[model samples]
Target: MTASPLLRSYDDGRLSLPNRIVMAPMTRGRADDVSAVPHPLTREYYAQRAGAGLIVTEGLWADPLGKGGPGIPGLVTDAHVAGWREVTDAVHAAGGRIFAQLWHVGRMTHPVTLPDGELPLAPSPVRIEHQQIFTKDGWLDHVTPRAMTTAEAEATIAAFAAEARNAVRAGFDGVEVHGANGYLVQQFLAENTNRRTDRFGGSLTRRLRFAVEVVEAVVAEVGAERVGLRISPDNPENEIAEEDAQGTYRTLVDTLAPLGLAYLHIIERGAYPALADLRPRWPGTLIANFNGPQPTTREAGEKVLNAGLADLFSYGRLFIANPDLPTRFAADAPLNPIRENLIYGGDAEGYTDYPALTPTPVG
Candidate 1:
């Protein structure tokens, strides 16, 4: 039978996806407090959502200093690798593909979240204004970050490459660099956030240096075919600001086009009209995330795909409440509403307990 557009299989011969629906990465904060290993519930959580064509795990910090907040998972130690193996095994057993999202939050964190109560690291000593980070103590105002020296910046790149190797060892199908949402990579990309006179800052090309280096290192560690990138241009989240969102992202995307990566995931809201102009420039598959206020529905996804805007559609909150999302979309079944309070740091209550579509009573 011919499949619906959303249900069509995507086999670029490198990344084989059963459908066009993807599960976007979201931080659930359910990892172990001390070790930063994924809790047992995390294993069950991904196993439940295995119906997604591709499941991108929550941001996994590459090292201790780069950690964002309490309970965020890490890929720095043997324990972390062992813990993630179970998750990947479960997803594969359930006939699903999964990817690890490598992340470094830079200055989007507080002392409580860092080791030895050290200051957060960034390209410059800029403190994100009017922002607070959750900690073991409580939400604390962000502190001025210490500018990373050239040596430290290069070391961070090496850490990302090392984590990519660890992700492969943990049995993930591929890896997605989390260069979005005002995190470390995005901090380097935005002009206002990066104010150095070095090779890693100043001009647009210099500002994009960190992201390109990290991607190159990961591509070297894992083949380019097994890697992907996520970016949100001009997004002001986490106090990020860009003077020229369109020009900067255009150059960045153009630079990345020749890498022969798996796909480019772009988070778009209606405000960024330039996103449309940037979409066609990417030669590989494009995953467009409708990050607006409204939930992404079948109609919206179909419209984008029909218009040749994106090859895959990524859903976040909806996927949180609907594990068998693809099946429900195919049947036009009712979706479960997300429990707002239970989204952050919860157990199975909001993570894995959402019921899938069940049969109605026989008359």
Candidate 2:
């Protein structure tokens, strides 16, 4: 059989991607909870999966207050920086390119995870209902978050900028702003979560201001060519609701189009045809992902590629189960099943212990 297009090299003048298969970010809660630092095995886990064209690491909190749960790795303290540096070095030594995903869970956080039991900060006092936040103690009811003062919001933007620099210092090739998955950025975008009347919210432009500013600040710290943004327009994950999903996201993409970003990674499982609409609108590289009960398969990604909808495609759970994902895709090798119970808060039993069929090429 001929080699699939998914395995072909892509050089777009900016990102010289070796293949279209991107190892999407998946949060594996295995960090040092108290220190918010990654363990040594984290390095081996990443290095073992270096066959992917690019690896967008699991979301890490840029600020101490940005942490959403236990074992969430951080870039805030010096210890955090050193821990991540080792992970980056391992991936690099294996000849792989990696991007740090800067994340802030915002109101998804519980007071139990916060400093001194302070309320989580969000665009407004909105809290997610129906779902509860899982903490170290146990499952806790989502509490109403404190509305972030305008000054605090500005400071948060700077914190992302600072961490972008920190990621570079740790040897990351680029940084992706985690604007998707109903986190802080999406909270500001969604009308139900953002009830602020200040410049950060109220209208379309205002609603997108926080996300746009965060991206711009990070781009300034790094370069536009080294920055990427992820978004899930109509995805109601974490109880987020966007009344005008199309308009809200259209304006956001159009606004950020001219910045010459490295790429725009989007989750395509929204209620609307978000990927179909935004693919043509975005002028830069486009990375597409589909979310569901099962892990993303090569067949699903091929459909997107054949439709001319995306330049790259990403896999989440598949990467976790099969460390040599690109090689397995090439050989049509059977993949290892994911251990649901050992996915989070575990040792090497589920993480670095996953066996690879054979060694994969670095590039």
Tens-place lDDT digits, model 1, residues 150-260: 899999999999999999999999999999989999989988789988989998899999999999999999999989999988777888887788888899999999999
| TM-score between candidate 1 and the true structure | 0.97
Candidate 2 per-residue lDDT over residues 1-363, each given as its tens digit: 347878889899989978999999989989988899997799999999989999999999988779999888998788888999999999989989999999999999998888888889999999788999989999999999999999999999999999999999888999999999899999999999999999999989999999999999999999999999999989988998899999998999999999999999999877888889998899999999999878888899988988899999999999999999888888888889998888898789899999999656698
- In terms of lDDT, the best-performing candidate is 2
Error of model 2, residue 52, in angstroms: 0.7
How many steric clashes does model 2 contain?
A: 0
TM-score of each: 0.97, 0.98
Q: Model 2: which residue pairs collide?
A: none
